[model samples]
Target: MMQCYGKSRVLTPTVVAAAAFALNKNRSLRTQSEEVGALDSWKKLWDTGMTRWHQRDVYWVLQKYGDDYIHKESRVLVPLCGKTVDLAYLTTKAKEVIGVEGVLQAVKEFMQENPNLQMEAVGSRNGFDCFRGEKIWLLCGNFFHFGPAVAGKFDVIWDRAAMVAINPSDREEYVQVLGSVLKPGGVLLLSGYVRPKGDVKSGPPFTLNKDQVLHLFEHQPWVASVECIESVNDAFSNEAWYKRLILRWRFGGVVSEDIWAIHSKAK
Candidate 1:
C-alpha cells in the first residue's frame, strides 16, 4: 500500500482525522508527496498580509454572476478556503458559507475582519471555528471534516484558491471531493494561476496545467456550462508569471459519470 501521509511532522491527529473523513467520501486523489508537504507548510505560513491570494480581485470576479445566478439562504462550500475574501461575496448571496481551511490562523483572521460576527468554537477532526452572521456562517475546518450532517443543498461553490492549492496529481480528487458538497445545479467558480512546471519553485502558491485541470472535471453529467477566463500576472513572482485560466463550471447534477469534467469548451 502507498504511504498516505507525508514526511511533514506537522501532520497531527486533527489533520489525519480530516483526511480520514475526506477519504471516506471519495477514493480518488492525485497529489504528490512534496505537493502535500507544501500545502501543509503553506497553511502554517498564513498571516493577515494584504498580499495574500484571497485578497485578489478573483473573489469579486467569482461572485460577479451571483446576484443573478445564485439564491438567498443557499449554502456555499469553499474548500481549502483560507481567509478567502471570496467568502465575503457569498455573504449576501447565500445563507451560510462553510469554508474548509486547514489552518486555524486563517479562521481567526477572518473573524477579526468581521468583528460583528458571533463566533463559537467547534470540534471536529482538525477543529473548526464557526462564525454565525446575520446572513452567513463561516465554518472553519478542513472540508474533509465537514460531516454528513451538512445536508442542506448548496446553490453554488466558490472555489477561488482551492483547486490551485494541490499538486497536479491531486487536482482530480479535489474536484470530486468539492463537487460532492453541492446540490445538483450548483455553480462552481474556480479562479487561480495555473503555473506551468518551468516557472513554479515553491507553492501553495502552486501550479496546474490547463489540460490536467479540464480532464479532471470534463465528464460530470451535471455540468451544464463551462467557461474559462485566462489572466496573466506577476502576483506570486515574475519567475512564475503565468496566464491563469478561471474555470466557471456549472453542475446540473445530471451525470452518469460521478467524475466531474472541466468542460474546456467553455474556454
Candidate 2:
C-alpha cells in the first residue's frame, strides 16, 4: 500500500515490487504506465469497494450471537474494522469500542457519519487520533498495532472480514497480533468468507477452507477453543458457493478445544 506519511508517499516493499510488475503490461509505456493504472484502479475501485463493504451492517452475526455476545458497557476491539456497522453493535453492548482501519477514506467517512464521536490524533507509533464518544473510538491505523500499549485492552475482539482480507503470506502475523490484543479470557467472534469467486486469486476478498482456517489459530498458545457457528451458502454466476464461517474462540482457546466445524456441519 502506498501510504502518505510526511511530505512523500511511502511504498511497502510488496507495493514497490507489485508496481514494477504492473508497469510491464503494455509494450509502449509498459511497466510504468501499467503501475499507474494498477494503482489508480486499486484506489478508485478495489479499495473503495472494501470501504463500502465494511461500512455495511453485521446484523447477521448479531442475530446469531444475540445478547450473550456481551453485556452493556463491555469494551470491544474491532481490527481493520473499516467503516463498519459492527461498531453500532459494539456501542449497544459495550461501553466503548475501538476500531482500527488502514485506509484514510473509510475513517474519514466513519467520523463524518458518527459526528457525535470525539477525535484526537495520536503520535506516530499509535497511528491516527482517538475518536471518543460514549461508546465508540477509532484508531485508523494498521491492524498489527493492536496489543496492550496502543489500545490498552479489550474483553472481546470481533474479527469478521479481517483475516481473509489479509494476504495468505501474512496470516501468521495476523494471528499473532490478534492474540496480543485480546484478553486472556476474552472472546473472539470471528467470521469470514470461503470459496469466494475462485478467480479471486489476487485479493482482499481471499477465502479459506476449514482446514486452513483452523491452522491459522492452532499454533497460538493463548487461544482456548475454536468452534464454528454456521456456514453461509451464496450463489455467484450460477455457481453454488460457500461464503462464511462464524467461529468462537474463548479464554484464548477454551481448555477442552472443540473444533472441526466443516466436518460436522458443512456439506
Candidate 3:
C-alpha cells in the first residue's frame, strides 16, 4: 500500500518492488517529440489530440490537499496548464486563478468547453492572448516567458504535472520562472512520478522523485521547506489513458507518485 505522510516517511525497497509489479509501469511514456518545454511540440500535441495528460476532472490531489493552503483571499497560479478543469475548481477556492498555457488551441478549447464559466477574450498582454472569467485568467503564450510583471505575484502555485513535463536541462530555468512570480511566504503544490533508480533519460513527463524535489527547492535561499505530503503506488494504473500508453511503451518499472508542498521563506 502507498504511504501518506503527514510528517515524513521512508521508502523501502519492498515498496518500490510492489509499485513496479502494480500499475506504475511506464510512467514516462511520452516521446521526445512531445517535450513540453518546446512550444511547437505542445502545439503539435494539442493539434493532433495527443493530450493524454489533460485530465477531465479536477485533480484528486488538489481536491484532497489544496484547501489546506488555498484560501478565498489567495491568488493562485497554474503554470504550463493545458486546458485543465483544475482552473475552474481553483476559481472557487482562490480570489483569482491564473493559468499559463503555451498552446492557443488548448486555451480556445478550455474556453469552449467551459462556456458555463463565461470566459471571454480580454485582449492581449505582453504578446499573450488573454481570456478572463469571473475569477480565472487564462494566458495563452510561452510559460517560461511569463513573469510577475505581467499579472503580479501569486500566493500559491499549483504545479501538477508541470515541472515533470519539462526537459531536465531546463528544470533550473523552469524553477526560476516559477519562483519569480511566487510571493514571499507562498506555497507550491507539486505532483509528479518518480522513476526507478539509475534510469536517467530525457522525458516530457520526466522522473522527478522526492529527493530531486528536495535538492531542487530546499537548497534555494528563498525556500523554507519541501515536504512530501502524499505518495501512492501505481497511482495512474486505473486511468484509461495510462492503460493505452503502456501497451505501446512497454517500459515496465516501479514508479511512485509524490505530492510535495514546498513553502517559500517569508521575506
Q: How close is every model to the real structure, measured as TM-score? A: 0.64, 0.66, 0.84
TM-score, candidate number 3: 0.84
Q: In the order shown, what is each candidate's alpha-carbon RMSD?
A: 13.0, 14.9, 9.6
Clashes of 3: 0
- Give per-residue CA lDDT, model 3, range 133-238, as digits (tens): 9899999886766776689999999998998887886676677677778888998899877765545474667888766776677546566677788788776766
Give the poorly placed runs of model 3, Cα more than 4 Å off.
1-37
Lowest summed-lDDT stretch of 10 residues in model 3?
A: 16-25
> Residue by residue across 1-267, what tens digits does model 2's lDDT show?
121112211112222221231111122322455435533543475354633344344545665564666677567888877677678667877778888876666676777776655554544445455655656777755555455777676777777667767667767756666666666567777765555334325455566555566676543455455556555443121221211222112111111111121111111
RMSD of 3: 9.6
Q: Which digits, one per residue and each the tens of the lDDT, describe model 1 over residues 1-267?
A: 122122212111222222332336446343456445754676656843433355543344545445755577577777777766667766756777667766767877877776655555544433456656555565655554354455344666766656656665556556656555656556676655544434433455455444444455545433444445433333233222122232111111111101111221111
- Residue 3, candidate 1: Cα error in Å is 43
Question: lDDT, candidate 2, residue 148?
Answer: 70
| Candidate closest to the true structure, highest lDDT | 3
Scanning candidate 1 in windows of ten residues, the lowest lDDT window is 250-259
